[model samples]
Target: MDNHPTTFPPAEEDPAYLVFLDSLDYLPSDDVARIKAAYAYAAKAHAHQKRMSGEPYITHPLAVAGAIVEWQMDADAVCAALLHDVMEDAGACKHELAEKFGKPVAELVDGLSKLDKMEFASYQEAQAENFRKMLMAMARDLRVVLIKLADRHHNVQTMSAMRPDKRRRIAYETLEIYAPIALRLGLNKLYRELQDISFRLIYPHRAEVLAKALRAARGNRKELLTRILENIRGKLEHAGLRAEVFGREKSLYSIFRKMQEKRLSFSQVLDIYGFRVVVENVPTCYLALGALHALYKPVPGKFKDYVAIPKANGYQSLHTTLIGPYGTPVEVQIRTREMHNVAQEGVAAHWLYKDGNESSAELQIKTHKWLQSLLEMQTSDSAEFFENVKIDLFPDEVYVFTPKGKIMAMPRGATVVDFAYAVHTDVGNHCSSARINHELAPLRTELRNGDLVEIITAQNAQPNPVWLSYVKTGRARSKIRHHLRTMQNEESARLGERMLRQELLSLGVVPISIPAAAWDSLVKASGQKSLDEVYTDIGLGKRLPSVVARRLLAREDMAGDAGSNMTLAIHGTEGMAIQLAHCCQPIPGDPIIGSIKKGSGLVIHTHDCPVIRKSRSTDPQKWIDVEWEPEEGKLFDIRIRVEVKNTRGVLAQVAAAIAEAGSNIEHVAMDADPERLMTSLRFTIQVAHRTHLAAVMRGLRHIPEVARIHRERGGEA
Candidate 1:
């Protein structure tokens, strides 16, 4: 009811529309006219439609347009906001809107419209698809998202009239998705409002309690905050530095999160209110900080210089916590007026594009870089893209320096691999090692603020698959996955070609005798673009090698020589196309059989493996005969479970036993069973063949502390 209209107010009578028009006074008359035309068209389209609150549907768009205008958005954004729901709610077509309003406004409206004609399996799927479409539009032009935030804001304001179930769902989504987007875009006020609204709707009782508590605390702490503000202002005035000091309270959602995260009661959560000092220039910002520190006893390790290194969203301020007059902890932020505007408005300040300001260009460059990254990730699946976007939403940043003194902002808990990728994809791909603060560290080492990072690269080095476990940033994760996928395709193609050649040899036909024309014919028959694609499909197990080989032989006019029986050889280093089963971990001496998995190539499992036994019984046709070639000095991973006495030095003794048997332990884990007197240790070790693994197990069995030892089958401990 705060800002919601309940009737169709005339254009001149509507406060929202009037405020929107007022904001557009600086725009050219032609642009203002175009925006007004859009508003009229939307109002006409929704003439008979009413909101759940019994308000004219036009009021919603008017409210949304007003919010966008408050952000100082462009005229195009304002027009788009007014028409965003027209295509979806009123059956207005994009072509008609384009003819009347323009292509840009039409496209924005089209992007916001849900795919209603196509049926979805569930509400969640439909919602996700809609969000995906909206994000795609935002990637092209950020105004789409600006309009979307406004729409969500107005919806939240009136959500009290909706059904409880629907309200909860919408509120949860707004909190999880839209609120984060607002924060990432630097719309702090919008972000905070969305969060507080959603929090109240989702937990009304808790919100009411917290609101009452906050009001009581505000009344009790009024005098203390006033004294602190006055003291800081006096210090700045005495220091000859002009400043305006004001008390700022933390938002309801922010307070709730802090309480929940720290498991603290409201009374225990001190320093809930802070002070902001707005200065004249950048230098005055530091001067104000010095003055505040001199006036109050500064709290050690409670200061951050964001002015020197801004946040990823280009927020700049100097934050310091001090011990106030009555031993109360008070936090203070100092920034110039321009910096304060950029901090509050975020990307909007840049998009507003005021003349005679270099800050606008700088802000534009920073926003464009972030937007380009989002566009690059658009090729990913909808779920994956959404996840990556969420990861980038909360940028709890840690600033680390390159060896050349160039500072890079990364998410806190980000590892060296993330830093390497942030520098460049090529550098990340070739990165082998790193040195943090002049000391050698693992690639998975967590980087700290102000640490100098030096990445060591080797041309032959490649991104380890394990890097995905530790890297934090979405850009790094997406790039690493992309590189690995390309590498997998190439490796699969090579392996597929070898398998086909071996199948041809089994048919008593020389593989070299197959001409280029035959490959082309096979490519056409298989509907693949090239021979490599056909081979890659075969390698990925999408098509069987025997089937492809027969097709090729038929194309070469040697169909009579095709053989039904073919055997594939494994060399223990088949790369991506052929994977050894981790459950069985078959070695060269083990009796291994191959199963053609869909899109995963050949999976090799031990003959006695329980998983392979079950699969063979259920789907016998998938089984293919495979033999390990006599490749000398090839290591295969095999797991051995050892039951050892729960005594001191028992783990060390077992490790020593395996090492003495000439086996290298790759990984070790203790099974979780507190009641058992004996502890179970699962070890993944590298050995040459089945005989080597057997010898290692026998050696472990001979240890006095080892109660039992055996090869783990099908991942059983």
Candidate 2:
């Protein structure tokens, strides 16, 4: 790849270096000199490489740097852009760049470089991991993503040189990932360009068709837009509002998406021609809106006051749809000059850190909040991380108010839980319920724009696992999963300790009084860091309590008799590690046996359980005699299969019978045998003991439609 001759673009064709320098017209001489040195170094390093378009590879970095300069990024960002590909392709080391240029530029370049040295199972895995690394780097220094976006912009712009398949893949990735990042960063120009370019590359024929259709529509609407612009300009001037009015055409990709979404043809898309009114001040913006509304009738319910409530990405504009001449629908946006700048530039408006001004600080602060969310989501698996990140990419925002009248911007369809997390992680984790608009609402209730949401939290409340099903934000999902995982670990540790104590008692050793030296020996033998960790592992089924007990006993020189007359009584509330076997639902008052499964602690099975009978021949050592404590009012799950005649209301009758017998149905399923004209109803009912379960079964047998009813062993019929 390096053997290719240098083929530089002509001065006119490649003015990227000059453009970059011109963008830095206000920069100090020292910064300018540093950037120049970076360019020279990168040019020399990439001198031997040539792009598929036959241009010297140096031009690519220059283009990327030029794009970054356009965003008014810092000199370090531009320098980093120039050297972004150096470490990956030109064998340039980050340390070498640090020594040559500076550490900041080197770190930015390192952040931009791919992890090519690490082997991956597939391209997707590598992509996800690379994205993960890139996001981390971005979180550390926002400039990394700015340079990367500049790099991607140039790549997508010049993607035509690649093969069709490669082009499509790159374009799809640009659409799915890069464009969203650009949008997230508030780089509207770059975002639109990326989307349009990706759409063109992925569907050239469709793009061409849309382009032609849009051109034709522009021709037909030329007179109409001209008249509308003139009238709006005249009205704004009459209203003493000094404004810049310009017609704006929607991008091909946006137009295509609208057509696909609304099932409309080119001609049916009436709002194809829009106008933007940039005024001098905030008041003038509203004045311009009123003037436009007076001239052309405003479309009801099509107005949005984003100025008062900015989008999550810090976008602010007053949007309204007006009916133009000839009944044509025309969209108009009104914003002040600063708002226009921020809207178009997004986060970049404040990313130019050299200013050190309040606006820059505000933008950095906003961007940092988003980056912190990415950090919170890092605990998720790679696929889940990527998927959750994707969920945050699209921003159809809804502006809702807290009970205190503080406005919060959330994605459309975000639930109450999302609102809670957006407020704070603690608030979200402890959110017990919510009141939407003064009415009690489910946590999964989708919040609407302008809804007053009041989150009800309790000091001891924790995130519900069920929240993962409806929580919209990645931050909330990650926080919930993290809390659940922590809680599970603590619970598992406790259960493991209990099971180990029981096992040790069986071996004639006191569990609580076990010496620290004995625990240390067991920890060393099991390769665990601490006694609690070992217990946790055993509780989570990573290790067996019996194994750990034997090791502990051996350390104490008491491993002679593994069996003992000691029995560990159960009250049916042992959280996770001690679980009743679903195959044979054992309750209080039933003869039961305890089997220590590796990592799973103790599993309780009825003495008559088929699973236990089947396992005895293969692994008799796993079984231990266990008994339930004489405790009442504890519910246990018992499955009962009832064969009934095919009739309506039969299920209701069977459920009523179980209820009449004082048992609650936990779950129910039905299997119908059409040939036999009978339906098998499987009921997982909660009862206090085996006698109650038997009574429920007898009650079901009394139903006229019931042909046969029997207690189900295990979860099977």
Candidate 3:
């Protein structure tokens, strides 16, 4: 063997960058010039700053801004992208930025800045609050959200430099918050990329395992993917259709998610890769799909024509999974160029809405409507803003149709009541009848897609408290609760005033009229907004009337002699007495009697309690005189046991019976021996009083398969 001198290859030179001027190939002259100037300003501002990975920090911001440009973002978003981190890392204030760029740009930068001065006990709490702040800011301006997403996308791309734990936390946050918002905004491409990148970091072992499997499987599909692409191109050409066909593999994260969701293992999973066909028009999308089905057996129920029914996020494509020549499942997606752009960039494509330049107006219109709802939902208290936004961010939506073909998206498991409220508060409060697909349906019926819903209204049909259990949408749930609470307060105040008057008469003390000034002072001292609020608090059990009376008496004594002990005790029932009841679980209703049990000051019991039954026969001296008084509605707990054969729908059947009987269940616990095929269920229900309790028990007893039903008091039959 001839041994020659070993030669080493010279190191490869770094890849040359396309100049900014060259990269502005398609951008308008004026727009390109503006961006070039912004680039220079940002470069100088970030000259000394460096990233954790040792790259100039300007590289990161520029990368983010470049992504924005790819999305065809407007001038404002571009500027915001360039300066997203200046305030956070450079110790610059919003005012300085405003002086340099403009108020809008500075505000966007401020919105992206975190409250770094404040210390958090845990990273989780800081992360949560930071996320809340981001969402709140996004609600105010659409550009803030777009730029933030861009920043997040680039950060994820370079996440390997961070510690594993930090990477995991960041990935989890991106998946939970950023990805969902992007999906909600119709940015499917960004959403998928974020999710896939996050998934890889969070589960590296699984990612590697899947990657290995994909490599092994690729050989089997390489020839197939190529043959399928060629066949599709030939067919499209034969049909006088111009199209571009490319092979597409399912992302590792996506395959992992599908397996997790469907409870399948690696081998059980199919449709590992597919092809995407981009055509010139909408009609061609359909025609290409037909050509595909002719070549392969289309999988039933795996076909979706989103072009006709685009998702709320504005994604439109023809998706079909087909069984190929060897019975392998292959997914194919068809879309036109415009649809493809929207599919990838989502609302970001709105940058092309104007003449030769779609401004971000279309995106602003869609996202702004949602953001406005967030603002409109602001409670009087700022403490509830973050809580409310959290509720709104949970976007498991169900798409329902109106009678006129309009699509409305509401939360999943939403009832007709939720639908009514989603339309308008007036519609919800006055809703009397609902027809889904032109047939009368119960208001609590769960809505499904493609169901044409029509609401029938009565002028006086105010929302009933019963609807709260069935309504799933937060808007409807909140509105109904608010209305009911208002009504309850008004009635409680009126009743409280009457009770106070009676007490004054029984005490042999004439009601003292408060001077206007004194009454106002009393109201203020009681921490009530109005006299009505004071009385309502007393009636609603939030305050004690006797306590208020004692305060008033002390004030009166300071002013003048109000009464003597004899006068104050004119009646035999001297001291203030209030007690909870046992039988019928009397709460604000039913005849109540005060009984002085030994050691217990005053034990109130419902007139029908078994204890009262025995007390009347023995030791009547312990019972004090008492009667029903006007009060507000309150919660009462009563238990019932149902013995039934454990059939397929026995639990559901009994629950439906009780619900129809109008008794609300506070809680339910059930026990059963599966082998014995029998079950005993205990339910703590809320009822108005004795009459309602009896009616509810009778209804449960009537349920089929209910072998027995009995009322119990603290486990006593």
Candidate 3 deviant stretches above 4 angstroms: 1-51, 54-59, 88-91, 115-133, 161-163, 352-364, 380-399, 410-412, 459-470, 481-512, 516-543, 547-590, 593-626, 629-717
**Model 2 residue pairs with clashes:** 186-346, 541-599, 541-600, 542-599, 583-714
Candidate 1: regions farther than 4 A off: 1-19, 117-121, 351-355, 494-538, 541-564, 608-611, 630-633, 638-717
- Higher-scoring candidate on lDDT, 2 or 3: 2
lDDT per residue, candidate 2, 1-717, as tens digits? 121113432243447667767788866877787777777777778878999989899889988888787777777887798889999999999888888777888898899999999998999988998999999999999889988888898998887779999999999999999999999888888899999999999999999998988887788778878988999899999998888999986888988898899999877874556899999877878878888889989999999998777777777789999888877888999988777777788788885434454444565678899998898889647777887898898868888999889988788889999999999999998998999999999899998989999999999888887899888887788788888778777877887787778787766678778788988988898887888888888677676566778888675454444544567687777665588888788898889988877756678888888767778667766676788876766888887788999988988998888899998888999898859599998888899987777788788777889999877885364
Ranking by lDDT: 1, 2, 3
| Runs with alpha carbons beyond 4 Å of true place in candidate 2 | 1-19, 351-361, 498-533, 544-570, 578-585, 591-634, 637-686, 691-717
Q: Give the winner by TM-score: 1 or 3.
A: 1
Highest TM-score scorer: 1
Q: What is the total number of backbone clashes in candidate 3?
A: 4
Worst 10 residues of 1 by lDDT: 1-10
- Per-residue lDDT for 110 in model 3? 86
What's the TM-score of every candidate structure?
Answer: 0.85, 0.84, 0.72
* Root-mean-square deviation of every model: 5.9, 5.6, 11.1
Better of 2 and 3 by TM-score: 2
Write candidate 3's Cα lDDT for 1-717 as tens digits: 111112321112312113434555667776655555555566666778788789877778778877777766666667678778878887778886776566877788888888777787766667656765776788887778888898999998897889999999889888877888888787877888998899998998988989899898887767877877787788788878889889876777878987999998876674445789999888888888888888778989898877787655666789999887667777899987777777777777776444442223444566777776665655543334445555556666668888888888777788898899888888998999899999999889999867889999899788788897777655776778777777666655764565445445544546676356766776889887888887776556555444455455444442223321221111112122233544545544455655544322345666667756866667554444455443335435677889999888888988888888887888898889768778989888876666677778888878779999876652253
Query: Which residue pairs come into collision in candidate 1?
Result: none
